[model samples]
Target: MNLAIALTAARYGAATANYTEVQRLLKGPDTGRVCGVRCRDVLTGKEFDVRAKCVINATGPFTDSVRKMDDQEVPNICQPSAGVHIVMPGYYSPDNMGLLDPATSDGRVIFFLPWEKMTIAGTTDSPTDVTSHPIPTEEDINFILSEVRNYLGPDVEVRRGDVLAAWSGIRPLVTNPDSKDTQSLSRNHVVTISDSGLVTIAGGKWTTYRAMARDTIDAAVREHNLQAGSCRTMGLQLEGAQDWSPTLYIRLVQDYGLESEVAQHLASTYGDKAFEVAKIAQVTGKRWPIVGKRLVSEFPYIEAEVVYGVREYARTAVDVISRRTRLAFLNVQAADEALPRIVDIMGKELSWCEQKKKEELETAKTFLYYEMGYKVKTDQLTDRSEISLVPSDIERYKKRFRMFDKDKKGFITILDVQRVLQSVSVQMDENTLHEILNEVDLNKNGQVELNEFLQLMSAIQKGRVSGSRLAVLMKRAEENLRRQAIPVDRSGGGL
Candidate 1:
C-alpha cells in the first residue's frame, strides 16, 4: 500500500525526499505568506532550502507542530490517538477470514484478521502524545487479547505467547479545543488554509486517503489559483499493477529455478516486477540453491528480495525486513534470526563498510526491541555471546548441534540429525529426515554441518518446510508445544 502511494506520487512528477525534515518554513516579505521550506536530510545530515509558490503542511499527527512553525500562536487542531495492533500465529482466525467487533467492552472497534499468513488483532483507540514511534503498552496488548477472545469461539483461544509482533500508530484525529476523547471525535478529514498560505490536511483513515489528498490538492490549486488539470487518478493503475496475475509465480519457478514458495512470495509482493527480481537471482554470482535460499527457512522470503529492496530505496535493514517484506511483522524471532544474512546482503549491495554494517544491524535490532516489542538479553559475552539477533532458538540449536556431533567435530551426520530430532521429541519419519538432510547438506555430502543444521532448524522453528514431509509433523509438534499454556510475560518486551 505504501509502495502504491509512492508510485502514485511519482506518476504525477512529485520529487520526494523521504527522510527529509522541515527545519522551518520559508516566508515572504509580506506577512501571512509561506513561499518555501528549509529542510534537512535525516540520513545524510545535509541541509537545503526549497522555494515554492505555496507550501503544504500535511504532516498528519504532527500537523500542529508544522503549523506552529508558521505561527506560534495557532491553536492545536490535531488530537492524536494511539492505536495498537498485535500479530499472532494464523490459527486464531479461519483461513482467509476476518472478524470485526464494531463495539467492544469499552465501546471501541477491534478487528481480528488474517494478514501475511499470520493473524493480526487490533486496535485500541486512546488519547496519546504525538511521537514518530509509539511503543505498544502491556495494557494495550492485554486489552486486544481479551477483546478478541470475547469474539472467538469457545474452542478457539487467544494466547499472549502466540503474539509474534506488536506495534502502535498515532491516529491524527482532528477537532476543536474541546477535550473530547479520540473515540468520540469524528474522523472526518479537514483541509484548512492558514493565513500564511500553509495548507494542512488531517483527520482521515486509510480508506479516505485519496479523498483527503484530492481535497488537499484542490485547496492548494484554489489557494494559489495554480493552473492544473483535473484529477486522473480515479482510473490510474498503481505501479506494479500492470501485467500482473495470480499465476505469475509459475513463470518465476519455471524460468529462474526458484522454489514455488519463494516464487509465489515474489510474485505476490512485486506483482509484474517479480520477473525483474528473479532475473537478479538468475544472474547473481551465488550458486543455484544458495542464490534462491530463503532468508528464514520456514518462510518464503529469500535473499534476492534484500538486494531488490535496497535498489527500491530501502536504506536500512529494518526497512527491508519490516516494510519490503513482512518478516519482522509476522515473526520477530524469525526476523531476528535472519538479520545477519540480510545485513550482509544489503551491505554488499549498498557498499557499506564493516562499521556501517554493524551500525545498521544494531539500528535494526533496536527497532525490533523497542518499537516491535521484541526483548534482547543484554549481558556479558561468552564464546556464544547473545547479541540482539541471537535469540534463544539460535543458542539452543548450537547446543543441540554440538551434542549430536559424536566426534566433537563441527559437523554432524544424517544419523546424528535424526538423533537431534528425536531428542526434541519430534518423530519425523525416515523419508522426511533424509529429505531434510538432502536439502541442507549443500555439498551432497552424507553429513550435515553445524551451520547447515542451524539453518535447517531455524527454518523449521516457525513455519512450513516446502517440498518436505517435515512440514506437517513439525507444524503439529510446534502447535502442541504452544498449547502447553506458557505463562504470559507482561513486562516490557514480548513473550
Candidate 2:
C-alpha cells in the first residue's frame, strides 16, 4: 500500500509533510471561513500554519471531532462495526480457494478464506459504543466457534489452544435518521458542506477511494472557485503504470515507434504513465515485473515509491496500510510480516530514528488491534513462577474430584474413594484403607466425608499444606462427601 501511495504521490508532484496534530484552526474575518489550519510537530515542537482558500476534512471516523474545530455539532455520525478472523492449520480445509458462509450462528457472514497455506475464518458483527480502541471479547470468540462447529461438525472444535491469531476491523458507517442499525446503513459516501464552509467527506469502501477522492476535490474546487489547473487525474497514469511487451520489439516499425513498450509499462504500473516508467526503466537498467516474474525488483521499486509517498502524499504507516494499500483486509500474518520491513524502509528513507520506527510499529499494532478488531497475542509471562502447578496436572485433579463427588455433593465417602481407586487399577487393601482413614475422615465420627476427601486431594496436589488450613477445609469436604457417599466393597478388595 505504501508503494502504491508513494508512486501516485510522485506522479502528482505533491510534497508530503507530517503534522503532529491540529492545535487550532485559523479562521477568516467574522469566523465564517476556515482560512488555514495550525499544527505543531510533535517531535520538534515547531508550529506551522497551512493557508488555503478551501479545506477538506478526510479525517474518516474522527469526522465529528474535526467538525467541532469549526464549533459545529455534527451529532454522532460514525458507527463502528467489529469483525473477527481465526487462523487454523492448512489441512482444515481443501480446495485452496476461500469459502464464504452467509449464515453464521450469530447472523453474520463467515469467510473461510485460503490465506497462504493456512485457512482463515471468522467475523462477528457487534456494536461498539466507544469511539476509541475496541477489542473482541470472549463472547465474540465463542460466537465464531459455535458457527464453525455447526457448519463443519461437532468433532471440529476451536479451543483457545488452536487459535494462532484473531483480529477485528471497524467499518465506519454513516448514521441515518431512518435506521438505527449500522449494518443497514448505506455503504455510499456523503460530501457535506458545513455552514462554516468546511467540506467533510466520509463513509466509503476501499475499492471506491479514487472515486471518492476525485469527487471530494471536485466539490472543493466548485465551492472555493479558486484558481487551479485542469483535473488531469483522469488521463494521468500513476508512476509505475507503464511497460512494453518483448514480442512487440521484433517489428522494425514498432521498434521505431516504441509505443507498445511504453503502453505495456504504463499498463503495469502507472496505468497511464507506462511510457514514463518504461523510459526510466530503460535508462536506469531497471526492469519492472512482467506478469509472471512476481518481480524481485518490485520491493526496491516500492522503496523508491515510498520515497515518493512520504515526499508527496500526506501518508503515515497507518494510512498506507488501511487506505492506500488495502492490506488490512489481507491475512493478519502477511500484514504482520510486512509491517516491520515497511517501517524500517520508510524510516531510513524518511530519516526517522529508532524511536520513530518503534512508535510507528506500536501505532500500527494498536490500529490493528483496536481499529481493525484483530487479536494480538504477546509473549509476556503471566505465570512466571517455575514452581507453580502444571495446568494439565491441575485439570486432571479437578476431573477426578468431580467424578468422586457424585450427586453434586462436595464430599466423598469411603465407598466413593474405594470405587474411584478401583477404577484406577489400584487395589483397595487394608494398608491403603488405613492410610486413607488416617489422612482423611476428619471429625472422627467413623465416616468419611467430602471435606476430608478434598483436604487429602489438596495436600497431595500441593505436596504440603498447613495443618490449620487442612482442618478448616476438611470440615466442609467431609459434609459434602457424606451427602454424596455411595455403597462399595467394605472388605479389602482388588480392582
Candidate 3:
C-alpha cells in the first residue's frame, strides 16, 4: 500500500531519494513564504536550488534530521522505538492465512504475518535512539524467537536456521514534547510548521500513510497560501492497481504463459499492471524461478521485476530486492543469488559506469547485511579466527546444526541460529551477532546450510572468531548441560 503511494507521488514529479533537500529558501528574515529546497544529487554530489511554495519534511524517524537542514538547532518531536521482525518459512502459517499474536511474553504486540512465501513474525518494541540503520540485538532475537515459539504448533519447533531474515525499523512515535510516559503523548498525527517555514510530518504507520501525506501537504499549502491541487490520492489509483481484479490473475497466467503461483504473486503485488511486468518475462525469455513444487518456489521474483524496479522505481539494488519485489525479505539465499543479477539488470537499464555499479553494490550490501540483519556469508574474509583448523570441532557443530535442520534436509535455516546457541547456553550482544554471522556465513546465504555452519563452529571453538570470540560458544552446550544439572563429559563427546 505504501509502495503504491510512493510510486504515485513519483509519477506526479516528486524527486526521490536521489536528491537530498540540503537547505531551505527564505524570502525575507522570519515571516517569509517558505520556498522549495536546495537539492544535492546523491550520485554526483552536485548541489542545485529548486522552488516550492511550501517545504514538507516527511522523513519518519529522521524528522529532526531534515528539519535541522533548515535550522540546526531544531529539536526532535519524534520518539524512535526499535522494532525487530523474524521471517520464518511459509509452512509456519498457511499461505492464505496469517497469525497475529496480540501480546508477547514482554507485554507487547507481535505479529506473524504470511508474506512472500514466508511467515514474517515480529516486531519487538523497545525505546531506542534514532538511527538510519537499526540492527536487531541478541536479546531482541532471543526474545522474538522465544515468544514466537510460544504460538507455534506443537509439531513446529522453530530454530534460528529456520529464520530466513531478521529486520528492525524505528517507529516515529509522537512524544509529549514534555513527558516520557507514552500515555502522555498524543496518538494522533501532528503536522507542524517549524519557525523556518519547514512543514514537518511524523508519527504514523502504514495504516496512516495516506492521511499523513494528505495532512502534510494540506498544511503546507494552507500555511504558505500556495495554490495546490486537492488531494487526488483519494481517487488516484496507483499505476498497477487501476482496473485490478482477481480474475486477472488467471488471465495473466494464460496470456503471459506464467505459472499459476507466479501469476498470483504478480497480480497481488503489482495489481492490474502486473501484465506489464509479466510481459517482460516473455519478451526476454526469462525463466520463472520455481524452486520446488508449484506451491513452494524460491525466487518468485523475475528479471522483469528487476527491470521494472530500476526503470520505474528508485532504480537502486536495495529498492529492487528489499522493497520492489521483496526478494530480500522473502528468502535470503534467493536474494543472494539475485542481487548481482538485479544489479546487472539495473546497471544496464540506468547506464551505470563501472564505478557506479561498485557504489550501488556497496550501498545495497549495507542494506542486506547490516540493516536487514543478515550476516553476509561470503568466502572473502581476512578474519583468520573465523577459519576452522579442527575437523572434530567442525563435525561437532555439524551435528548440532542438524538439530536445526528440523525438516532433516541436511541444511540449516533462518530460525536456527539463536535458538541452537541459546539452547547451548551461548548468548552475546546484538553487535557481536552481526559481526560473527557475517564472517561465519561462508556462502553468505544467511542460513547455515551444508558445511558452512560446521566451518563456523570449528572457528568459534578455536577462539578465532571475533564477535563469536567474546563468549566462546563452546560454553553454551556445556553450560546448558550443567544448568540442567546433567554432567557432559567432553571425553564422551556430544554433537
Candidate 4:
C-alpha cells in the first residue's frame, strides 16, 4: 500500500514534498483552525504553501510538533523508544536461520536473525528525547552485546573494535493514558483530528504502515468530504511484483496482501522498478556461488542492484547496503567481495570516473566503519577472510609506507597511512589519521610535511596518541594528502 501510494503519487508527478523546518503555524486563519502549512525547502531555501481541509501529521515520534501547530495545548503525544542491532561475521553460528532471544539483559526481546549470511542480533528498549538523527551511544552497544553474549556464549565478543556497524532507530509509539512503561505503549496507531482540523497519525511499525495510511486517509476523506475515490489500495499491485514465482509471490502476498508483488519488489528495492536488475541477474553463461546458492553471475547481480539503487531510488551508497539490501548485516564478506564489481558497474552506469569510484568506495567504507559499527580489517583488502594478524610486522609496515609515498614527497595521505597501518596489522580508528594531522600541522597550512607526518605516525604507532589529539593528527594527514596535487604510487601498498 505504501508503494502503491508512492507509485500513484509518482504517476501523477507528485513533486517531492517534505516539511522545511516548520515556521510558526499561521495564526487567526480559518477561525483559529490550522489553515495552511508554511514550510521552506531545507535544500533550496524555497518556501511553499499547502492548504488543506484536514492535514495529516504522520511525522512518527515528532507528532507533538504538529499538535503545537494545531493549538499548543495538545500535550505530549509520543514516547520515543530505540532499537539497536549489531552485525557479526557470518561464521559465528552454525545455522543460517535467525535466532530469537526472548529475553535481553535489559529485559527486552532480542532478535538474532540471519540477515543475508551475517548474523544480526539486537535490540534494546529505552526511552529517549525526540531528535532528527538519533545515534546509539556506547552504553547501548554494551547493553546489546552483554545480552547477545549471554545467548551466543561468552566467546561471542563484541568489542568496540569488532563492531562493523551499529544503528539506532526510533519508534514513535503512541502515548498510553494507562501504561507506565513506554515499551507497553501501543504499537497501534491513533488518528485524532485536532480542534484546528489537523489529523495526526501517531504510532505504528513498518509492518502496519498500510493500515495507518488507510485510516489516516479515510478520516481525511470523511472530514473534508473530498471527492477522492474509495480505497483502491486493497487490490493494487506494486511495480515488478507480478513476475516472482508462486511460492515467493505468495509469501509476498501474505506480507503485503493485495499489493503483494509490488510490495515484494518495493520491500526488496524500496519502491523502484527493478526490471533492469532482473535482466542483470538472469542466468548467464557463467555461474558463481553466493552463500552456497549458484548465481548466474558472481556479483553482477549485486552490482546491478546497487546501480538500480543509486539511479532509481535516490540512494546514497550507504543507503544501498544499510537499507536497500541486507548486505551490511548479511555475509559481510559478500559486500566486501562485491565492492570492486559494484564500483565498476556503478562507474559504467553513472558515467563516473575512477576518482568518483574511489570516492564512492570510501564513502561506503566510512558508512561501514561508523554507521554500521563494522570493524573493518584494515590489513585485509577484502572482508572474506576471517584471519587476524597473530604477530605485528614492523618491517612490513615501513616498507608499505615507503612504497605508498608515491611521489616520494616524504609525506603520506591518510589513505596511505591507513594502508600502511593495516599492512602492519594495526587497526586505527576511521577518523584517527585525519585528526592526527590537524594537531601536528603547527603552521596550520593544512599539509603535514614529512617531519610532522612522521612524528604523528610515530605517536600513533607507539601507542601514545589518544582522544582529540589523535583525531586531529589523523584528520589533518588525510586532508593534506587528499588536497595535494601529487599522486601516490598506488602499487607500493602491495596490492
Candidate number achieving the greatest TM-score relative to the actual structure: 1
Clashes of each: 1, 42, 22, 35
lDDT of 1 by residue, 115-136 (tens): 8778899999999998887999
| lDDT: worst 10-residue window of model 3 | 288-297
Write candidate 3's Cα lDDT for 1-495 as tens digits.
666766777888976564354654544455554576666776577888876666777778877777666776766677788889878788888888776777567688888778766788888888898876688876787788888888877866566666777888888888644455646444467887776677888787877667877887778778777777756556667767777897888887676677777778888888987877776663434464322112124555667777766666466788887877776676655565566767777889999998988888888887777766666544454444344445665566667787778676446654577777666655554445555566555544455665556555554444344465434544553454467775543332332
- Which sections of candidate 3 miss by over 4 Å? 1-3, 10-19, 23-33, 71-74, 153-155, 176-183, 228-230, 282-297, 353-359, 376-495
Which regions in candidate 4 have their CA more than 4 angstroms from the true location?
1-5, 8-15, 18-28, 93-97, 153-162, 176-184, 246-272, 278-301, 313-315, 328-369, 374-393, 400-495
TM-score for each predicted model, relative to the true structure: 0.74, 0.54, 0.72, 0.61
Q: Evaluate residue 355 in candidate 2 and report its C-alpha lDDT on the 0 to 100 scale.
A: 91
Tell me model 2's lDDT, rounded to 2 decimals: 0.56
The TM-score of candidate 4 is 0.61
Supply the TM-score for candidate 3: 0.72
Score candidate 1 by TM-score against the native: 0.74
lDDT of 4 by residue, 1-495 (tens): 343456566765665453256655654443877666787877468887766555678788888886786676667868889877776655655565667777555468887765544566778788888876566676777777676666666644444434445777889878643455544577788888876667788898888766877888898888768899655556556554555443453443343232333334433553334434433432223332111111112222234456566555433455555555566554343455556666666677778888988988888776665555544333322222111221243344445566877766445665666676555444545655555545555433343444454445455433334443554454444444456532332332321
| Winning model by lDDT | 1
Better of 3 and 4 by lDDT: 3
